[model samples]
Structures are given as C-alpha cells and as structure tokens.
Target: MPHIKQILCIEDDLFIGEMYRRSLTKAGFAVDLIASGDEGLKAATNKQYDLILLDVMLPEKKGTEILHALRGEGKDLVPNSRILVLTNYDQDDESKMAMQSKADGYLIKADITPRRLLEIIYSLDVQSTGAE
Candidate 1:
C-alpha cells in the first residue's frame, strides 16, 4: 500500500492529540493535529489532507456538523478524504449521529489499545469515506 500522508487530527485533548500525531508520523503520515472542530474546519478549507481524524465533541461544533460540510461533492476544499471518528463516547445516540454523518470508521477511545488502532487504520479500505 502507498504511504498515508497529510493527516488532520481534530481532537481536543492535548495529550491524545500529541499521541495521535506521534503514531501517524511514526507510520510515515504527515499530521496536522488540532484541538477543536472549528480549527479543523478552517484548516480543511485550505489544506487537502489524505485523512481526517475527528472527535465527536468539539469546542465550536460537533464532528457531525463538520462531516456534513464535507459530504457534499462541491467540497473542493480538502483532498479526496475519509474521516475517522475518534471519541470516548460510543453511546447509541453518538453512534447514530456518526453513522448518519457517514464517518468512514469509528474508534471508541476507551476500548482501543494503540496497537489495535494501528491495525484498524491499516485494515481500512482506501476507498472508505464518510462514517461507520
């Protein structure tokens, strides 16, 4: 497989953000890690990333809102990208919202080990875009 470059990580936790950047960078992916949905959205307007790692809860808006913005085809903003939902809450409502938003994959923070996350990333199909 080709290397994964240009990753956008939209998570609020500083420690987790750093950890995700480290993980993706170590795996040869260039990462733009941010702490809020609003920041991520701004960056998306100018930067075309290969993948977007989004969190459910964000400062300005939820990941669902961001995902909706990215879904319509005219989104000539970002690169042909896929979104990976990374959140601690996998509750029914959260899952439904994510699925509705069409997230490419869902990773429940509490249930994932680092190695397991790597496996999930690798296993994802390149064409996978949107949620669930």
Candidate 2:
C-alpha cells in the first residue's frame, strides 16, 4: 500500500544489477544493489525495503536459504517487505522451496526486461493499496 520508494536487489551479476539499478532509479525508486547473498541477507534483515528482488544463486549463500531465513527466523524483522525471487534458474525444487518459504513472487531473469519488471512492481503496489 505504501509507495514503493525503496528496493533491494540481491543479484550476483554486476551487469544485471546495474541495469536494474539504472532503470529503477530512473523510474524514481531508490535501489540498493548487493552482489552477494550473505550481504544481501544482512541488508534485508537490517533495513526495511518496499520490495526485494532476490536472485537464486550467489557466492556466499543461495537465495532460497535467504528466503527461509527471512520467512522463518527473521520474519518479524521484515514484516512489510514484498520479496520477489528473480533468478535465471528454472529448477522446480528451488522454485517450490521459495514458494514454500512464502516468496511474494518468482521470476526468471532471462524472461524479464527492466520495463516489464517495473510493470510488475507497479502491479504489486496496486494490489497492496487495493487501487486500480
């Protein structure tokens, strides 16, 4: 419901992160791009974000592990953030795990463009606010 002004993108690929950062920032959202899963978890826990765009694989931790942690032990810490799993991996088990962990949405990076991602975020905002 609250305007989605802040977003955290936990992506390992620098190029993709930059692309998202540029697009999101240009669209008037403040975006934090973290390249590793460990740091991503730390940021997600320590700070509040309107939305979290999480990748599945990373150097220190997997996104699924982060989802479990957030939805499990750290649930109270990030109560309002909408977490969207954004990964190129199409593995069924991982997607199932993320959904079981209560991820708001799951997306494949290769299938999404920056513009389309922004549209999805806008739709999420609309859904939250119950606005058309």
Candidate 3:
C-alpha cells in the first residue's frame, strides 16, 4: 500500500483551502494547507512534500514568483514534489506564467471536481513512488 507523506497547498481562499484539505485527506493524503505564497515558499524550502497545490494570486507573493524562485534555487520541488497550479486563473497571462515557471499541471479551481482532484493527487503520488 502507498502512503501519502505530505502535500503543501498554497491557496489564500479559506474555503478552497479547507475544501482541498478535507478532500485530499479523505483520499488518504496528508495535507498542509497554507494561505500565503510567501509562507508556502518558506515552508516548502524547509520541508519535503509529495506534491504541491499552488494558487496564482496570493498576498505577499504570487505563485509564479514562488515557483520560479524554487526552480532557480533548484529546490527539487518539481518532478519530485510535482507542483500543480490550482487557481482561478486558467489559459491567461497568469496561467502562462505558471507554465513558464514549470508547473506540472494547471487546473482551474472552478473546473475541479473532488474526484478529479483526487485523481490528480493519486497520479502524483504514483509518479513519485515510481521515480523512487
């Protein structure tokens, strides 16, 4: 059986963060829900996660900036951690920036069903295990 170690979710919206936390946890994943991108970046730098769910707009820092900073720092948050952008922004300049920052997957919050999010999380966990 596969176990979920950790998931860092950087979303400012309280409702969304709580929802994802509850949903992912119900799917057998340990989730750390954060509200600020800066805080998320700091937490990520200090700890290792199985996956990351980031929102585009955040107070103090933007998702793209955090993602790019992590990539530049070679934080190994990619392929390993699997950064997934879960934001309201989809197919716009912000989304483009996220892609440029090396987001593994970009998901629109509105389009995300609970089941779909679980699928994405499972896929990430599977990929991580395969890589190891």
Per-candidate local distance difference test: 0.74, 0.88, 0.79
Residue by residue across 34-96, what tens digits does model 1's lDDT show? 898888888876787767888878889787777777764445344466678888865588656
Tens-digit lDDT track of model 2 for 1-132: 477889999999999999999999999999999999899999999888999998988889998888888886645457788889888877788566745468788888899999999999999888887852
Off by over 4 Å in 2: 73-76, 94-101
Kindly report which residue pairs in candidate 2 clash with one another: none
Ranking by TM-score: 2, 3, 1
Q: Is candidate 2 or 3 superior in lDDT?
A: 2
Give per-model TM-scores: 0.80, 0.90, 0.83
**lDDT for 123 (candidate 1):** 66
TM-score of 3: 0.83
**Which 10-residue window of candidate 3 scores lowest in summed lDDT?**
72-81
The order by descending lDDT is 2, 3, 1
Worst 10 residues of 2 by lDDT: 94-103
